[model samples]
Target: MVDRVAARAHETIDRVAAKAGPAVEKLRESASTYREQLHAKADRLGALEEQWIDSARSYVREHPFTSLAVAAVAGMVIAKIFSSSHHR
Candidate 1:
């Protein structure tokens, strides 16, 4: 009787595993697709960041004085914001 019970349990586990095989494979394929999509998006974002950096560099090179003035003004504004927030 004990042997019979053990055999039945093994059979049940085997059946469950067989039933789950296709579902597990489907999940793996879906995960691979999502991974591919995420990689593509990351690549595009990296390119966009490079483009923005290049454009900013060009702008600064063309207008060094203007860029310096803008940066100074921006710095003052940021400092004021931070100081006021701290006082509050």
Candidate 2:
């Protein structure tokens, strides 16, 4: 009886592992696909960011005075926000 019980337990474990193997493989494939997709998206976003930076640099070169005024206004706005938060 003891031998029979141990054999049954071993069979049960083997069956569970067999059933789970395919499911685990499917999950791995899904994760790999998602990883590829995320990498593609990251690459595209990096390209877009580079283009934007290049455009901004060109614009700044073309209009240095406008950029300086914009920067000064942005600085004042940021300072005001920080000062107000501190006061509160």
Best by lDDT: 2
lDDT (CA) for every model shown?
A: 0.99, 1.00
Query: For candidate 2, what is the lDDT?
Result: 1.00
* TM-score of predicted structure 1: 0.85
What's the CA error at residue 34 for candidate 1, in Å? 1.0
* Per-residue accuracy of model 1 over 1-88 as CA lDDT, tens digit each: 9999999999999999998999999999999999999999999999999999999999999999999999999999999999999998
Clashing pairs in 2: none
Prediction 1 global C-alpha lDDT: 0.99
> How accurate locally is residue 15 in candidate 1, as Cα lDDT from 0 to 100?
97
Q: Write the per-residue lDDT of candidate 2 for residues 20-57, one digit (tens) a residue.
A: 99999999999999999999999999999999999999
- Clashes (backbone N, CA, C under 3 Å), per candidate, total 0, 0
